[model samples]
Target: MPTTEPGRRRRPRASTVIVGALLTVGALVTAFPFLWMLFASVKPRGESVAYPPHLIPSEPTFEFFAQLFNELDFGRYLVNTLAIVAICMLGLLLMAAAGYGFAKFTFPGRDALFFLVLATMMIPGQVTMIPSFLIINGLNLTNTLIGISLPMLVSGFAVFLFRQFMATIPTEVLEAARMDGAGEWRIFFSIVLPMSGPILAVQVVLTFIAGWNSFLWPLIIANDQKLYTLSVGVSLLNQQIATNPSLQMAASTLMVVPILIVFVVFQRYVVQGFTLSGLK
Candidate 1:
Protein backbone atom coordinates (compact mmCIF):
# COMPACT_ATOMS: atom_id res chain seq x y z
CA MET A 1 0.00 0.00 0.00
CA PRO A 2 1.23 3.48 -0.84
CA THR A 3 1.54 5.76 2.14
CA THR A 4 -0.08 9.22 1.91
CA GLU A 5 1.38 12.25 3.62
CA PRO A 6 -0.91 13.78 6.30
CA GLY A 7 -0.40 17.23 4.74
CA ARG A 8 -1.61 16.05 1.30
CA ARG A 9 -4.78 14.50 2.81
CA ARG A 10 -5.48 17.68 4.74
CA ARG A 11 -5.13 19.81 1.60
CA PRO A 12 -7.93 17.94 -0.21
CA ARG A 13 -10.15 17.98 2.88
CA ALA A 14 -9.64 21.72 3.26
CA SER A 15 -10.41 22.26 -0.46
CA THR A 16 -13.67 20.28 -0.12
CA VAL A 17 -14.76 22.39 2.87
CA ILE A 18 -14.03 25.64 1.00
CA VAL A 19 -16.01 24.46 -2.04
CA GLY A 20 -18.98 23.48 0.11
CA ALA A 21 -19.10 26.83 1.87
CA LEU A 22 -18.89 28.75 -1.41
CA LEU A 23 -21.68 26.63 -2.88
CA THR A 24 -23.91 27.20 0.17
CA VAL A 25 -23.39 30.96 -0.04
CA GLY A 26 -24.05 30.98 -3.78
CA ALA A 27 -27.26 28.95 -3.37
CA LEU A 28 -28.55 31.27 -0.63
CA VAL A 29 -27.89 34.39 -2.72
CA THR A 30 -29.65 32.93 -5.74
CA ALA A 31 -32.61 31.68 -3.72
CA PHE A 32 -33.23 34.85 -1.66
CA PRO A 33 -35.28 36.74 -4.28
CA PHE A 34 -37.40 33.68 -4.99
CA LEU A 35 -38.04 33.22 -1.28
CA TRP A 36 -38.98 36.87 -0.91
CA MET A 37 -41.30 36.78 -3.91
CA LEU A 38 -43.14 33.69 -2.62
CA PHE A 39 -43.60 35.19 0.82
CA ALA A 40 -44.74 38.53 -0.60
CA SER A 41 -47.21 36.94 -3.00
CA VAL A 42 -49.17 35.31 -0.19
CA LYS A 43 -49.27 38.32 2.12
CA PRO A 44 -52.34 40.57 2.44
CA ARG A 45 -52.37 43.36 -0.19
CA GLY A 46 -51.45 46.22 2.17
CA GLU A 47 -49.16 44.12 4.39
CA SER A 48 -46.88 43.01 1.51
CA VAL A 49 -45.13 46.37 1.54
CA ALA A 50 -45.65 47.21 5.21
CA TYR A 51 -42.87 49.03 7.09
CA PRO A 52 -39.87 46.91 8.21
CA PRO A 53 -40.71 44.45 5.38
CA HIS A 54 -41.66 41.24 7.12
CA LEU A 55 -39.91 38.19 5.69
CA ILE A 56 -42.92 36.07 6.63
CA PRO A 57 -46.43 37.47 6.65
CA SER A 58 -48.40 37.36 9.91
CA GLU A 59 -51.62 36.92 7.95
CA PRO A 60 -51.43 35.24 4.56
CA THR A 61 -54.18 35.52 1.96
CA PHE A 62 -55.03 34.37 -1.60
CA GLU A 63 -56.68 37.65 -2.53
CA PHE A 64 -53.79 38.55 -4.79
CA PHE A 65 -54.05 35.30 -6.72
CA ALA A 66 -57.81 35.72 -7.05
CA GLN A 67 -57.42 39.31 -8.28
CA LEU A 68 -54.76 38.27 -10.76
CA PHE A 69 -56.98 35.58 -12.26
CA ASN A 70 -60.15 37.66 -12.31
CA GLU A 71 -58.91 41.15 -13.24
CA LEU A 72 -55.73 40.41 -15.20
CA ASP A 73 -55.54 38.53 -18.49
CA PHE A 74 -52.91 36.19 -16.98
CA GLY A 75 -54.56 33.02 -18.28
CA ARG A 76 -54.44 34.25 -21.88
CA TYR A 77 -50.81 35.28 -21.44
CA LEU A 78 -49.93 31.84 -20.08
CA VAL A 79 -51.57 30.07 -23.00
CA ASN A 80 -49.83 32.29 -25.55
CA THR A 81 -46.46 31.70 -23.90
CA LEU A 82 -47.00 27.95 -23.87
CA ALA A 83 -47.95 27.87 -27.56
CA ILE A 84 -44.92 29.91 -28.62
CA VAL A 85 -42.53 27.79 -26.54
CA ALA A 86 -43.95 24.57 -28.02
CA ILE A 87 -43.47 25.83 -31.56
CA CYS A 88 -39.95 27.06 -30.83
CA MET A 89 -38.97 23.71 -29.35
CA LEU A 90 -40.19 21.80 -32.39
CA GLY A 91 -38.33 24.08 -34.78
CA LEU A 92 -35.14 24.05 -32.69
CA LEU A 93 -35.11 20.24 -32.61
CA LEU A 94 -35.25 20.12 -36.38
CA MET A 95 -32.47 22.68 -36.67
CA ALA A 96 -30.33 20.77 -34.17
CA ALA A 97 -30.72 17.59 -36.19
CA ALA A 98 -29.68 19.43 -39.34
CA GLY A 99 -26.62 20.84 -37.60
CA TYR A 100 -25.69 17.40 -36.29
CA GLY A 101 -25.89 15.96 -39.81
CA PHE A 102 -23.72 18.71 -41.26
CA ALA A 103 -21.10 18.32 -38.50
CA LYS A 104 -20.99 14.55 -38.43
CA PHE A 105 -21.49 13.71 -42.12
CA THR A 106 -19.84 14.68 -45.39
CA PHE A 107 -21.44 16.91 -47.99
CA PRO A 108 -20.54 19.58 -50.51
CA GLY A 109 -19.94 23.03 -48.99
CA ARG A 110 -20.98 21.72 -45.54
CA ASP A 111 -18.10 23.39 -43.72
CA ALA A 112 -18.46 26.61 -45.73
CA LEU A 113 -22.20 26.72 -45.04
CA PHE A 114 -21.82 25.93 -41.35
CA PHE A 115 -19.07 28.51 -41.01
CA LEU A 116 -21.34 31.05 -42.71
CA VAL A 117 -24.11 30.20 -40.29
CA LEU A 118 -21.68 30.42 -37.36
CA ALA A 119 -20.45 33.78 -38.60
CA THR A 120 -23.92 35.25 -38.21
CA MET A 121 -23.80 34.59 -34.47
CA MET A 122 -20.95 37.12 -34.24
CA ILE A 123 -23.34 39.86 -35.44
CA PRO A 124 -25.38 41.57 -32.74
CA GLY A 125 -29.05 40.62 -32.57
CA GLN A 126 -30.04 44.30 -32.44
CA VAL A 127 -28.50 44.90 -35.87
CA THR A 128 -30.76 42.30 -37.44
CA MET A 129 -33.87 43.09 -35.44
CA ILE A 130 -35.41 45.53 -37.92
CA PRO A 131 -34.75 43.33 -40.95
CA SER A 132 -36.18 40.31 -39.14
CA PHE A 133 -39.25 42.30 -38.20
CA LEU A 134 -39.71 43.37 -41.80
CA ILE A 135 -39.53 39.76 -42.97
CA ILE A 136 -42.06 38.61 -40.38
CA ASN A 137 -44.30 41.55 -41.25
CA GLY A 138 -44.06 40.66 -44.94
CA LEU A 139 -45.13 37.15 -44.10
CA ASN A 140 -48.11 38.64 -42.22
CA LEU A 141 -47.14 36.75 -39.07
CA THR A 142 -46.78 39.76 -36.76
CA ASN A 143 -49.08 39.93 -33.70
CA THR A 144 -49.46 36.13 -33.82
CA LEU A 145 -47.85 33.31 -31.85
CA ILE A 146 -45.99 32.31 -35.04
CA GLY A 147 -44.38 35.74 -35.12
CA ILE A 148 -43.41 35.52 -31.44
CA SER A 149 -41.75 32.12 -32.01
CA LEU A 150 -40.14 32.84 -35.41
CA PRO A 151 -36.93 34.55 -34.32
CA MET A 152 -36.07 31.73 -31.90
CA LEU A 153 -37.05 28.82 -34.17
CA VAL A 154 -33.55 28.45 -35.58
CA SER A 155 -30.87 29.24 -33.01
CA GLY A 156 -27.17 29.48 -33.84
CA PHE A 157 -26.38 28.51 -30.25
CA ALA A 158 -28.40 25.32 -30.53
CA VAL A 159 -26.72 24.46 -33.84
CA PHE A 160 -23.28 25.10 -32.38
CA LEU A 161 -23.96 22.93 -29.33
CA PHE A 162 -25.47 20.11 -31.39
CA ARG A 163 -22.66 20.17 -33.93
CA GLN A 164 -20.00 20.06 -31.23
CA PHE A 165 -21.74 17.12 -29.55
CA MET A 166 -22.25 15.17 -32.80
CA ALA A 167 -18.59 15.68 -33.79
CA THR A 168 -17.57 13.66 -30.75
CA ILE A 169 -19.51 10.58 -32.00
CA PRO A 170 -17.25 7.78 -33.30
CA THR A 171 -16.70 7.51 -37.07
CA GLU A 172 -16.51 3.72 -36.79
CA VAL A 173 -20.06 3.46 -35.50
CA LEU A 174 -21.35 5.50 -38.44
CA GLU A 175 -19.36 3.40 -40.95
CA ALA A 176 -20.63 0.15 -39.43
CA ALA A 177 -24.19 1.36 -39.70
CA ARG A 178 -23.64 2.35 -43.30
CA MET A 179 -22.23 -1.07 -44.09
CA ASP A 180 -25.29 -2.68 -42.55
CA GLY A 181 -27.43 -0.92 -45.18
CA ALA A 182 -28.76 1.71 -42.82
CA GLY A 183 -29.86 4.88 -44.60
CA GLU A 184 -28.62 8.30 -43.52
CA TRP A 185 -31.85 9.28 -41.77
CA ARG A 186 -32.10 5.82 -40.20
CA ILE A 187 -28.55 6.02 -38.88
CA PHE A 188 -29.22 9.45 -37.42
CA PHE A 189 -32.54 8.55 -35.85
CA SER A 190 -31.65 5.08 -34.58
CA ILE A 191 -27.91 4.84 -33.94
CA VAL A 192 -26.56 8.35 -33.44
CA LEU A 193 -29.60 9.70 -31.62
CA PRO A 194 -29.73 6.80 -29.15
CA MET A 195 -26.09 7.50 -28.26
CA SER A 196 -26.73 11.22 -27.76
CA GLY A 197 -28.78 11.07 -24.57
CA PRO A 198 -26.69 13.57 -22.62
CA ILE A 199 -26.52 16.17 -25.37
CA LEU A 200 -30.24 15.81 -26.15
CA ALA A 201 -31.17 16.35 -22.51
CA VAL A 202 -28.90 19.38 -22.47
CA GLN A 203 -30.39 20.73 -25.70
CA VAL A 204 -33.98 20.18 -24.57
CA VAL A 205 -33.44 21.98 -21.26
CA LEU A 206 -31.49 24.88 -22.79
CA THR A 207 -33.92 25.37 -25.66
CA PHE A 208 -36.96 25.14 -23.41
CA ILE A 209 -35.55 27.72 -21.01
CA ALA A 210 -34.61 30.05 -23.84
CA GLY A 211 -38.05 29.74 -25.35
CA TRP A 212 -39.68 30.27 -21.97
CA ASN A 213 -37.70 33.38 -21.04
CA SER A 214 -37.55 35.09 -24.43
CA PHE A 215 -38.71 38.69 -24.06
CA LEU A 216 -37.49 41.17 -26.65
CA TRP A 217 -38.44 39.34 -29.83
CA PRO A 218 -41.79 38.36 -28.39
CA LEU A 219 -42.39 41.92 -27.26
CA ILE A 220 -41.70 43.28 -30.75
CA ILE A 221 -43.70 40.70 -32.65
CA ALA A 222 -46.59 40.16 -30.27
CA ASN A 223 -48.21 43.59 -30.41
CA ASP A 224 -51.46 42.13 -29.10
CA GLN A 225 -51.82 42.00 -25.32
CA LYS A 226 -53.43 38.59 -25.69
CA LEU A 227 -50.19 37.21 -27.19
CA TYR A 228 -47.82 38.44 -24.50
CA THR A 229 -45.19 35.99 -23.20
CA LEU A 230 -44.46 35.50 -19.51
CA SER A 231 -41.59 37.97 -19.48
CA VAL A 232 -43.59 40.68 -21.22
CA GLY A 233 -46.56 39.87 -19.05
CA VAL A 234 -44.40 40.29 -15.96
CA SER A 235 -43.17 43.65 -17.27
CA LEU A 236 -46.79 44.75 -17.70
CA LEU A 237 -47.45 43.57 -14.15
CA ASN A 238 -44.64 45.86 -13.00
CA GLN A 239 -46.60 48.77 -14.46
CA GLN A 240 -49.61 47.86 -12.30
CA ILE A 241 -47.60 47.10 -9.16
CA ALA A 242 -48.03 50.66 -7.78
CA THR A 243 -51.79 50.24 -7.53
CA ASN A 244 -51.96 46.45 -7.08
CA PRO A 245 -48.68 45.46 -5.43
CA SER A 246 -49.92 42.14 -4.13
CA LEU A 247 -51.43 41.13 -7.45
CA GLN A 248 -48.24 42.17 -9.21
CA MET A 249 -46.23 39.94 -6.89
CA ALA A 250 -48.63 37.09 -7.58
CA ALA A 251 -48.14 37.54 -11.36
CA SER A 252 -44.37 37.72 -10.96
CA THR A 253 -44.45 34.67 -8.69
CA LEU A 254 -46.43 32.76 -11.30
CA MET A 255 -43.95 33.70 -14.06
CA VAL A 256 -40.98 32.44 -12.03
CA VAL A 257 -42.37 29.16 -10.70
CA PRO A 258 -42.36 27.24 -14.02
CA ILE A 259 -38.78 28.29 -14.75
CA LEU A 260 -37.73 27.25 -11.24
CA ILE A 261 -39.36 23.86 -11.71
CA VAL A 262 -37.58 23.35 -15.04
CA PHE A 263 -34.21 24.31 -13.56
CA VAL A 264 -34.60 21.97 -10.62
CA VAL A 265 -35.61 19.04 -12.83
CA PHE A 266 -32.84 19.51 -15.44
CA GLN A 267 -30.07 21.18 -13.49
CA ARG A 268 -27.74 18.20 -14.00
CA TYR A 269 -28.11 18.32 -17.78
CA VAL A 270 -27.74 22.12 -17.77
CA VAL A 271 -24.46 21.84 -15.81
CA GLN A 272 -23.16 19.04 -18.05
CA GLY A 273 -23.88 20.97 -21.25
CA PHE A 274 -22.20 24.12 -20.00
CA THR A 275 -19.16 22.14 -18.76
CA LEU A 276 -18.75 20.13 -21.96
CA SER A 277 -19.32 23.13 -24.23
CA GLY A 278 -16.79 25.15 -22.27
CA LEU A 279 -14.18 22.42 -22.82
CA LYS A 280 -14.64 22.76 -26.59
Candidate 2:
Protein backbone atom coordinates (compact mmCIF):
# COMPACT_ATOMS: atom_id res chain seq x y z
CA MET A 1 0.00 0.00 0.00
CA PRO A 2 1.14 3.55 -0.74
CA THR A 3 2.27 5.57 2.29
CA THR A 4 -0.24 8.22 3.39
CA GLU A 5 0.89 11.77 2.86
CA PRO A 6 1.34 13.92 5.96
CA GLY A 7 -1.57 16.34 6.71
CA ARG A 8 -1.08 19.98 5.78
CA ARG A 9 -0.80 22.56 8.59
CA ARG A 10 -4.07 24.06 9.72
CA ARG A 11 -4.74 27.76 9.28
CA PRO A 12 -6.28 30.10 11.88
CA ARG A 13 -10.03 30.39 11.51
CA ALA A 14 -11.38 33.56 9.82
CA SER A 15 -13.36 34.40 12.97
CA THR A 16 -10.20 34.22 15.10
CA VAL A 17 -8.32 36.43 12.68
CA ILE A 18 -11.15 38.98 12.63
CA VAL A 19 -11.45 39.01 16.42
CA GLY A 20 -7.70 39.48 16.86
CA ALA A 21 -7.67 42.33 14.35
CA LEU A 22 -10.55 44.05 16.11
CA LEU A 23 -8.87 43.69 19.48
CA THR A 24 -5.60 45.09 18.16
CA VAL A 25 -7.43 48.12 16.75
CA GLY A 26 -9.24 48.64 20.03
CA ALA A 27 -5.99 48.52 22.01
CA LEU A 28 -4.31 51.05 19.71
CA VAL A 29 -7.26 53.40 20.01
CA THR A 30 -7.25 53.12 23.80
CA ALA A 31 -3.50 53.67 24.08
CA PHE A 32 -3.23 56.49 21.54
CA PRO A 33 -3.82 59.37 23.96
CA PHE A 34 -1.41 58.04 26.57
CA LEU A 35 1.21 57.49 23.90
CA TRP A 36 0.52 61.04 22.71
CA MET A 37 1.01 62.45 26.21
CA LEU A 38 4.23 60.54 26.80
CA PHE A 39 5.59 61.94 23.54
CA ALA A 40 4.24 65.46 23.91
CA SER A 41 5.64 65.83 27.42
CA VAL A 42 9.16 65.45 26.08
CA LYS A 43 8.69 67.32 22.78
CA PRO A 44 9.60 70.96 22.12
CA ARG A 45 6.62 73.26 22.81
CA GLY A 46 6.18 74.20 19.13
CA GLU A 47 6.51 70.54 18.05
CA SER A 48 3.91 69.42 20.60
CA VAL A 49 1.31 71.51 18.74
CA ALA A 50 2.54 70.95 15.17
CA TYR A 51 0.20 69.64 12.47
CA PRO A 52 -0.53 65.89 12.57
CA PRO A 53 0.29 65.86 16.32
CA HIS A 54 3.72 64.33 16.86
CA LEU A 55 3.76 60.95 18.64
CA ILE A 56 7.54 61.02 19.01
CA PRO A 57 9.70 63.80 20.37
CA SER A 58 12.06 65.32 17.78
CA GLU A 59 14.08 67.27 20.39
CA PRO A 60 13.25 65.77 23.77
CA THR A 61 13.65 68.07 26.81
CA PHE A 62 12.73 68.05 30.48
CA GLU A 63 12.05 71.78 30.64
CA PHE A 64 8.34 71.52 31.40
CA PHE A 65 8.91 68.84 34.05
CA ALA A 66 11.54 71.11 35.62
CA GLN A 67 9.05 73.93 35.69
CA LEU A 68 6.48 71.61 37.26
CA PHE A 69 8.82 70.58 40.07
CA ASN A 70 10.96 73.70 40.60
CA GLU A 71 8.67 76.62 39.87
CA LEU A 72 5.18 75.10 40.38
CA ASP A 73 5.75 73.55 43.84
CA PHE A 74 4.84 70.11 42.52
CA GLY A 75 7.27 68.49 44.96
CA ARG A 76 5.00 69.51 47.83
CA TYR A 77 2.01 68.26 45.86
CA LEU A 78 3.79 64.96 45.20
CA VAL A 79 4.54 64.55 48.89
CA ASN A 80 0.91 65.27 49.69
CA THR A 81 -0.26 62.73 47.13
CA LEU A 82 2.04 60.04 48.51
CA ALA A 83 1.02 60.72 52.11
CA ILE A 84 -2.69 60.50 51.30
CA VAL A 85 -2.15 57.36 49.24
CA ALA A 86 -0.34 55.76 52.18
CA ILE A 87 -3.23 56.58 54.50
CA CYS A 88 -5.60 55.06 51.97
CA MET A 89 -3.60 51.83 52.19
CA LEU A 90 -4.06 51.83 55.94
CA GLY A 91 -7.79 52.32 55.41
CA LEU A 92 -7.85 49.28 53.14
CA LEU A 93 -6.54 47.11 55.96
CA LEU A 94 -9.34 48.28 58.23
CA MET A 95 -11.87 47.63 55.49
CA ALA A 96 -10.45 44.15 54.99
CA ALA A 97 -10.94 43.36 58.66
CA ALA A 98 -14.50 44.65 58.51
CA GLY A 99 -15.05 42.57 55.40
CA TYR A 100 -13.77 39.48 57.19
CA GLY A 101 -16.20 40.12 60.03
CA PHE A 102 -19.08 40.53 57.61
CA ALA A 103 -18.08 37.43 55.65
CA LYS A 104 -17.49 34.91 58.45
CA PHE A 105 -19.21 36.03 61.62
CA THR A 106 -22.89 35.44 62.27
CA PHE A 107 -24.81 38.28 63.89
CA PRO A 108 -28.26 39.80 64.33
CA GLY A 109 -29.63 41.74 61.33
CA ARG A 110 -26.59 40.71 59.30
CA ASP A 111 -28.34 40.93 55.97
CA ALA A 112 -30.06 44.19 56.86
CA LEU A 113 -26.82 45.74 58.09
CA PHE A 114 -24.96 44.70 54.99
CA PHE A 115 -27.79 46.10 52.94
CA LEU A 116 -27.38 49.43 54.72
CA VAL A 117 -23.70 49.38 53.88
CA LEU A 118 -24.50 48.77 50.23
CA ALA A 119 -27.11 51.52 50.35
CA THR A 120 -24.50 54.10 51.19
CA MET A 121 -22.84 53.44 47.85
CA MET A 122 -25.96 54.57 46.00
CA ILE A 123 -25.63 58.10 47.45
CA PRO A 124 -23.47 60.15 45.12
CA GLY A 125 -20.24 61.62 46.47
CA GLN A 126 -21.30 65.08 45.29
CA VAL A 127 -24.36 64.95 47.55
CA THR A 128 -22.27 63.94 50.56
CA MET A 129 -19.45 66.42 49.89
CA ILE A 130 -20.96 69.36 51.76
CA PRO A 131 -21.80 67.28 54.81
CA SER A 132 -18.40 65.63 54.85
CA PHE A 133 -16.73 69.01 54.53
CA LEU A 134 -18.73 70.36 57.45
CA ILE A 135 -17.95 67.36 59.65
CA ILE A 136 -14.23 67.53 58.90
CA ASN A 137 -14.18 71.26 59.48
CA GLY A 138 -16.11 70.85 62.74
CA LEU A 139 -13.48 68.34 63.83
CA ASN A 140 -10.72 70.89 63.04
CA LEU A 141 -9.32 68.72 60.26
CA THR A 142 -9.83 71.13 57.36
CA ASN A 143 -6.75 71.93 55.27
CA THR A 144 -5.02 68.96 56.89
CA LEU A 145 -3.93 65.61 55.44
CA ILE A 146 -6.14 63.84 57.96
CA GLY A 147 -9.22 65.59 56.63
CA ILE A 148 -8.35 64.74 53.05
CA SER A 149 -7.77 61.13 54.10
CA LEU A 150 -10.92 60.62 56.21
CA PRO A 151 -12.99 59.83 53.13
CA MET A 152 -10.33 57.47 51.80
CA LEU A 153 -10.25 55.20 54.85
CA VAL A 154 -13.12 52.92 53.95
CA SER A 155 -15.77 52.49 51.30
CA GLY A 156 -18.80 50.29 50.77
CA PHE A 157 -17.28 48.92 47.57
CA ALA A 158 -14.13 47.80 49.42
CA VAL A 159 -16.17 46.02 52.04
CA PHE A 160 -18.35 44.37 49.43
CA LEU A 161 -15.41 43.15 47.38
CA PHE A 162 -13.62 41.87 50.46
CA ARG A 163 -16.72 40.15 51.83
CA GLN A 164 -17.38 38.46 48.51
CA PHE A 165 -13.83 37.21 48.24
CA MET A 166 -13.56 36.14 51.90
CA ALA A 167 -16.75 34.08 51.60
CA THR A 168 -14.81 31.60 49.49
CA ILE A 169 -12.80 30.62 52.64
CA PRO A 170 -13.94 27.32 54.08
CA THR A 171 -15.82 27.25 57.38
CA GLU A 172 -13.77 24.23 58.47
CA VAL A 173 -10.57 26.31 58.38
CA LEU A 174 -11.91 28.83 60.86
CA GLU A 175 -13.39 26.15 63.08
CA ALA A 176 -10.14 24.22 63.12
CA ALA A 177 -8.25 27.38 64.07
CA ARG A 178 -10.72 27.99 66.88
CA MET A 179 -10.30 24.42 68.06
CA ASP A 180 -6.54 25.02 68.16
CA GLY A 181 -7.18 27.95 70.52
CA ALA A 182 -6.40 30.69 68.01
CA GLY A 183 -8.21 33.97 68.63
CA GLU A 184 -10.59 35.47 66.07
CA TRP A 185 -8.15 38.28 65.29
CA ARG A 186 -5.36 35.77 64.85
CA ILE A 187 -7.37 33.66 62.44
CA PHE A 188 -8.34 36.79 60.52
CA PHE A 189 -4.93 38.41 60.39
CA SER A 190 -2.95 35.26 59.80
CA ILE A 191 -5.12 32.80 57.89
CA VAL A 192 -7.84 34.82 56.21
CA LEU A 193 -5.60 37.70 55.18
CA PRO A 194 -2.73 35.60 53.89
CA MET A 195 -5.22 33.56 51.88
CA SER A 196 -6.80 36.74 50.52
CA GLY A 197 -3.73 37.88 48.58
CA PRO A 198 -5.38 38.14 45.17
CA ILE A 199 -8.38 40.13 46.30
CA LEU A 200 -6.18 42.27 48.51
CA ALA A 201 -4.04 43.10 45.51
CA VAL A 202 -7.17 43.89 43.54
CA GLN A 203 -8.53 46.21 46.22
CA VAL A 204 -5.12 47.83 46.72
CA VAL A 205 -4.85 48.77 43.06
CA LEU A 206 -8.42 50.09 43.03
CA THR A 207 -7.98 52.12 46.20
CA PHE A 208 -4.66 53.58 45.13
CA ILE A 209 -6.07 54.62 41.76
CA ALA A 210 -9.08 56.21 43.42
CA GLY A 211 -6.93 58.02 45.95
CA TRP A 212 -4.53 59.26 43.32
CA ASN A 213 -7.33 60.57 41.15
CA SER A 214 -9.26 62.12 44.04
CA PHE A 215 -9.74 65.76 43.12
CA LEU A 216 -13.02 66.98 44.54
CA TRP A 217 -12.60 65.93 48.16
CA PRO A 218 -8.99 67.08 48.36
CA LEU A 219 -9.76 70.33 46.58
CA ILE A 220 -12.60 71.13 48.97
CA ILE A 221 -10.84 69.95 52.12
CA ALA A 222 -7.30 71.11 51.40
CA ASN A 223 -7.28 74.90 51.41
CA ASP A 224 -3.57 74.98 52.22
CA GLN A 225 -1.41 75.17 49.12
CA LYS A 226 1.08 72.80 50.79
CA LEU A 227 -1.46 69.96 50.76
CA TYR A 228 -2.43 69.94 47.09
CA THR A 229 -2.50 66.55 45.39
CA LEU A 230 -1.49 66.17 41.76
CA SER A 231 -5.06 66.28 40.46
CA VAL A 232 -5.91 69.50 42.30
CA GLY A 233 -2.56 71.11 41.56
CA VAL A 234 -2.51 70.20 37.87
CA SER A 235 -6.08 71.40 37.49
CA LEU A 236 -5.14 74.78 38.95
CA LEU A 237 -2.06 74.83 36.74
CA ASN A 238 -4.30 74.20 33.73
CA GLN A 239 -6.43 77.21 34.64
CA GLN A 240 -3.38 79.52 34.87
CA ILE A 241 -1.42 78.24 31.85
CA ALA A 242 -3.98 76.66 29.56
CA THR A 243 -2.01 77.54 26.44
CA ASN A 244 1.09 75.45 27.21
CA PRO A 245 0.66 71.92 25.81
CA SER A 246 4.00 70.63 27.11
CA LEU A 247 3.33 71.55 30.74
CA GLN A 248 -0.17 70.14 30.61
CA MET A 249 1.05 66.93 29.04
CA ALA A 250 3.80 66.62 31.63
CA ALA A 251 1.29 67.07 34.43
CA SER A 252 -1.01 64.49 32.85
CA THR A 253 1.90 62.07 32.67
CA LEU A 254 2.64 62.69 36.36
CA MET A 255 -0.98 61.90 37.26
CA VAL A 256 -1.11 58.74 35.14
CA VAL A 257 2.32 57.10 35.69
CA PRO A 258 1.64 55.93 39.24
CA ILE A 259 -1.70 54.44 38.24
CA LEU A 260 -0.07 52.64 35.33
CA ILE A 261 2.69 51.21 37.50
CA VAL A 262 0.19 50.08 40.13
CA PHE A 263 -2.06 48.39 37.58
CA VAL A 264 0.86 46.77 35.84
CA VAL A 265 2.18 45.38 39.12
CA PHE A 266 -1.22 44.01 40.13
CA GLN A 267 -2.82 43.37 36.73
CA ARG A 268 -2.52 39.59 36.88
CA TYR A 269 -4.24 39.32 40.25
CA VAL A 270 -7.14 41.64 39.38
CA VAL A 271 -8.94 39.22 37.07
CA GLN A 272 -8.19 36.34 39.40
CA GLY A 273 -9.67 38.27 42.33
CA PHE A 274 -12.88 39.00 40.43
CA THR A 275 -13.16 35.37 39.35
CA LEU A 276 -12.62 34.00 42.85
CA SER A 277 -15.08 36.49 44.31
CA GLY A 278 -17.79 35.41 41.79
CA LEU A 279 -18.02 38.93 40.44
CA LYS A 280 -18.96 39.37 36.77
Clashing pairs in 1: none
RMSD of each: 3.6, 2.4
- Which lDDT values do the candidates have, in the order given? 0.80, 0.90
C-alpha lDDT of candidate 2 relative to the true structure: 0.90
Cα lDDT tens digits, model 2, 87-108, are 9999988999988989999999
Backbone collision tally, model 1: 0
Model 1 stretches astray by more than 4 angstroms: 1-23, 238-242, 277-280
Clashes, model 2 = 0
